[model samples]
Target: MKNDRAPFPRREPSQVTGQRARPQEVLGLFATVITVVVLAVMILAPVARAATSSFVFVGRGNGHGVGMSQWGAWYAAREESKTFAEILAFYYPGTTLQAVKDPDTVLKVRISSTPWKSNTTSFSQVDLKPTVASGTLRKYASNSDSDFTTQTISAGVLVRVQNSGGKVRVTVDDTSVGTFARVDLVPGGSGASEGRNNVQLKTTGGTTVDYREYWGTMRVQPGDDSGELWVYNFVALEKYVRSIAEVDYDWATIGGAAYAPEAVKAQAVASRTYAVAKDGATLADNWADQCYRGYSFEAKYPGIAQAAAATAGQILTYQGEPVTAFFSGHSGGYTTVSAWSGDTALPYLVAKPDPWSLGAPPASMHSQGPGWNWTYTISADNLSKKVNGSLKDTSGRTVNVGRISSVDIVSRDTSDATSHAKTLRLTGAEGTATVSVLSFRSLIGTSNLPSTLILSVNGDVGTGGTDDPGSGGDPGTGGDPGGSGGGPLLPGEFYDVGAGHLYHDQISRVVVAELMGGYEDGLFKPEGTVTRAQFAKIAVSLHNLMNAGDKILVVNVTTKPFDDVAIDSKTTGDTSDWIAAAKKAGLISGTSSSSFSPFVEIQRDQMATMIC
Candidate 1:
């Protein structure tokens, strides 16, 4: 047992069962929960945003919108009762799960490389501290890991390899150790890959790209005899597989109930299979390959090791060869084709509906992060900048447009209930520009767009961007103020706040100016009560509008004025920033010295005082 950190109950290699008879068709696999899944999906909130004139996009899923969606697997296992093989078969169809012949095969995993010196094209040196929990450290002059001699040293020995005088110079504890063609830092006299204890690699102000403590043997060999070295953590395939932190294993603690274990077993097989397929120095230690955080992650999440152990020697094979199964965080609502990324489309990697990713048992909606069905509103000006920036580097595409006033979907490629944007047309002052949805996402950033699968501009958008912030079209220019019930209705006013209503003009002007807007569901809810926090945000916006040259922006929002108003990372911006601005403007004096009745309904006099 590893004594480094608290771990889950250890399971034997054969305990975690692999491969059951796969259902014939995809529909049959999820048929048991089909009705519930569909019904739950149908009630999902339609894409809505505040009545702001920005280009609001409403969509589903996240990640690259392809392969096995982690969110979908979570719902299928947690709520739908699907097993690991069943989930794997659903995402990667036409594939079979099989046990591998050699799970203990050695794997050279790239942990990270030393930073390339600036203003030069090559790396100079690497500084790493070698240690072990039980075994001593050794500087192997030859590739033979077990051939330990006088070079064997205790733990906490700092080793630095420098490229000087046409040879790899080795310095230990600030003294010349020796120079050799290949420098191997082994953990005791153990075999390079299958070791009893791991050689921990710690950064002593040397590496920056992926700076973290690592597991297994640390090997430093010249990349190509150019005095350049490539570093790797040489661990047995099983140890490397067990440390892949791909999904949220700690999620089981939610509601004091454990999440399904089979989902992680499925991931273990996928990660193991993906790793088994790679060779040479092409693989990496990031999401591009798979997030392999080595020992520390394995210690923190014992479930990862448990899953890998359970699925040891298990891999997904297509035909006879093992498959490189691709998985991602979320898939909006559908798994897409590899062709969507300009890669060779595989027969089994076709598009499929991933309803579980949308949400199931609506009560638990967004118990996961905001990836399910999310909304992002970008102003016309910002969209134009992203479009031009993307086109600036493209060889064939050129941008003549200034500020984009329109964003329209030209085509969509969907698998089922959810759709992904394929082509988008942007219109601006000078002219128009067309961009593939993939290119657009690459330009604007995935953090904002998340996934093209759910790209719906301006409310499941359709075509064209909104002329105003709100997608309800114009909020009407003309209305009889304080009218009991008179005058012709103008173009586009809130269903409740119309020409017949009193103070219609006042509401229209405010909505147009974006001083206020309706809920995300597009409802005015005029009769709804307002809290001090809500009114504070509005007052600050009004102040900014009046003082455009000196726009009021409150920095240091971490310093809170009211105890009730949250200022943490979850609520870092927007309302929090404006709330601080409101307090500074004397618009809101908390109910007492420290407490602000942020959620309590504001009285008419309090509203009147805020307006004053």
Candidate 2:
């Protein structure tokens, strides 16, 4: 009997010939391994293994971890009597079972109408095999159906639609089912050969599914003509779930069952609404009822939404209510999301590690077909927001750029128009700076259009260029490389509100490099039209960049009597403080003109003045 404590006793190898000790050592090692295994078993006997508390029985197969499990669907069809609709519901759970709602979505089917349309056979007398015996349609077909052959068709098994005049049209269930392609229909058919016979199927959606074909022969037709009438008898090789925009809640499945306060539900609803609305949409429909697309938006797009969300608190506002939401998903499976604050960044963080970690496995709709692989991804929904923040060179100095006061994001998929909304507040002692607006739509091919990054005063949309802050030269010469006519910092150096330095300052090279990268030479244009929101973001960024490991200071923009201005609100950092400082320093004029157009492009002259 092996000793429970002795897993492997050290043993010296035989040194007889200097060669490794042969079979005996090998046997000894093998025995030692076995002894260790047995010892482990013996030692483990005293401590009972923990029993599995529960079995989740996640849906079969893999992929997006939502919708129907392709393999499960197939298995159910083969081993059980469930239909496609039933499979989808079983996997998706709380979803409302409904026909695919998109009109543009199409399902291809194949059918055999050849023998039935020969005219010699009556619809009632003709016996037909299941149509659409192969390809993509096979997934939706009956498990036992087989394709038609010449021997089977020539058997004259049932009602035969004989082509007496070589022309015949077979109508099934009041719809023409088939048509002979040639004018001379099989030697002797009835009408013209090129007309069509059709069959109409009543679907759950109250719409008639029509199957029609022309120029196809019946019976043991030669070379490619056999089984041609079954063009509509497709076996749904693949069922594509159409893309629909929606607001998906991650923890909603827990419901009240989990230990939480009643306010949690309210918060969940509010968050969901806020998220959807940020992209300019609303969530009237239940996301659970829709296909559990999982957290595709957050998982696919990382850093993008969180960055935007963190700034959203100070940027977007509507009717005194701060609104922010995220977006995700493309036509197929590509998805991303926008976050209005850092607090909402968790969803993306957790989902990114494993894309298909949620919901039940998908079911394959048919048997004997390859399983369909579903993919899910999450990313920052409003990338434009981050792009905007990065575009502005937020040196310590104040520019006329409009700072974001609050944020509101909307999901583009939902048409509710007003659900997604979130709020963020900037504090004075925060670690970072900059604000962004998360836009769901993509600017695929419109680079020439002016960018609506943070709204700058002088109309500069993105980063500075040759035109920004104007020419760096003497007033009369108009060609100096340095932007700072006589400011403390160099042309390419950044400046904080109160921080002072000489023309040839000894600032950190990183800040100088950033400024240089932002502009040519070093001319700080003082008369720039930086938007109110952009000024806030740039100020914070510049301060942080210069201090490196040091935190920046900011003051809040005071509440304005203007209907659109809400001063008390804060963002991720001391947004209020910075806004207030800028406002106090005459850097930004509050929204006195009813609305602050933050998206307006900046101008060279305006940039120069703002820098000044």
Candidate 3:
């Protein structure tokens, strides 16, 4: 939102005479009028020109160009007769497909919660009743002031849970029920972790809805800060996967027609693998994780359910452990490595050619999706505003490089037989600054720049120029048709040297190792000691890399190896799991027989020994 208008010139009123104006006076008046008109044109011309000046972004694809492309998978299945396994192999080159033996069949999903931000007086109510499938429902109530208390309710009983003024009140069949900070509903005789129970609820609008048949227990809690109500559902993994497939993929249409069964099946496996790899930390109803709308979504798309059932318990694995199955709407013409997508390079996630996205036969017969190729025209002033707003460097530090004057694509990757920009140089009034392609996309807005597989950036410099307008040219040339100059850094390369050691190549190598494994950011703090928790994560990553392609046994232990690294410890976050895994791998030992000094930092020599 830059103001590109030129300043308007001041105007003087014309002088009039009482009698007929003299010929010289008339001439002078005409000259003055002409001068005024010329001034107006001069003032408005640049504004008009800038208003019309637009940066034409000719690009292809959608979402981050990483892992599997959903559109590509669909095309492959339909045109090349590729099976689900074949499609997965084509995308995740070095990964294997394996079944999870005795995997946790149940998942706890937070379906509905009070809005993160709400007015002080705002409130919400939820009506609940047990379904026929669920027998003898019991409620466990708890609050900040009391322990959990249990009560039994009939299957057909109507229960209303309301939140107001940070207090939760419950009522059954119009009778006042006890108020509590939290409530959990489970099968009468079943433990919290046992049984698949279903519930029916009525919306505030009086619409009846049947939620998913959840396993384990359902928790209803008052929001801690927002004073809102939260409803959590514990559903079976297969059921959750089925619901997510429908939400993530267009079941009714892909390429303007019903999606092929195989395509849907591929989606099912990918979604299932993604959920299974979460290590029980993802919320079932979270869009950041997976979109799960409970039984309503599952019932609406019977086809999705069928697809999930067809691939039940199946997941994409690397070496025997679940692989991080990332998927996107499109790959623009080629798929890229994880590093290009702001992640560390993974052996299974290498860049590769995507013929499906190039529009393979059979699937190509239908109308193309919007993300197949797209163009956007944005004003230069607007572009500068966007760049000045939130551009950042490799170390996640914000960069204020003033108004952008030009943008040059410096470095690109052609390994996948497709060209994509990896580094971009932004020339502004303040100075020229270099940023990753991902950072540029983020600063300009993802919806505007879609993918890094850009064809050309026309009007990147100044107001007007005879730049090649959307030529879909080769990116490796490193030429900005818009008449700009700069060189790009090595693709996927981050960090030049360590902060403390001026010439220590070994420390830089360790930093590189950590970066490659997605452990450290671009900065290499060589003089900085490694914390116990940090070392645990590094050691675990190394262990995984050394045993790549082997089935890793994911241990489910209730007890912590060190009392300080307990599950609920605020300091550990999720690193406790890594600490336990490192101990199991014999990569680290506690300072004492039973205590792991998790907060203590290890010296450089000790870190070298541990790494060795």
After superposition, candidate 1 runs with Cα above 4 Å error: 1-53, 113-150, 154-158, 162-167, 188-215, 221-229, 251-258, 279-281, 338-341, 360-371, 392-395, 415-417, 463-612
Q: Pick the candidate with the highest TM-score.
A: 1
- Candidate 3, residue 8: the lDDT equals 6
Give one digit per residue, the lDDT tens place, for model 1 in 70-187: 7666666776777788788777776778887676677776654321111111345665565443333455556675654446544666677766555567887798977765566656
lDDT of 1 at 611: 48
List clashing residue pairs in candidate 1. Answer: 52-469, 52-470, 53-468, 53-469, 53-470, 54-469, 59-454, 60-332, 61-332
Count of clashing residue pairs in every prediction? 9, 177, 5
Off by over 4 Å in 3: 1-53, 112-123, 134-138, 141-147, 164-167, 187-216, 246-257, 338-343, 360-371, 395-397, 413-417, 459-612
Best by the lDDT measure: 1
The local distance difference test score of each candidate is 0.57, 0.25, 0.54
Model 1 has an lDDT value of 0.57
lDDT of 3: 0.54
- Expressed as tens digits, the lDDT of each residue in 358-385 for candidate 2 is 1111112111111111111111222233
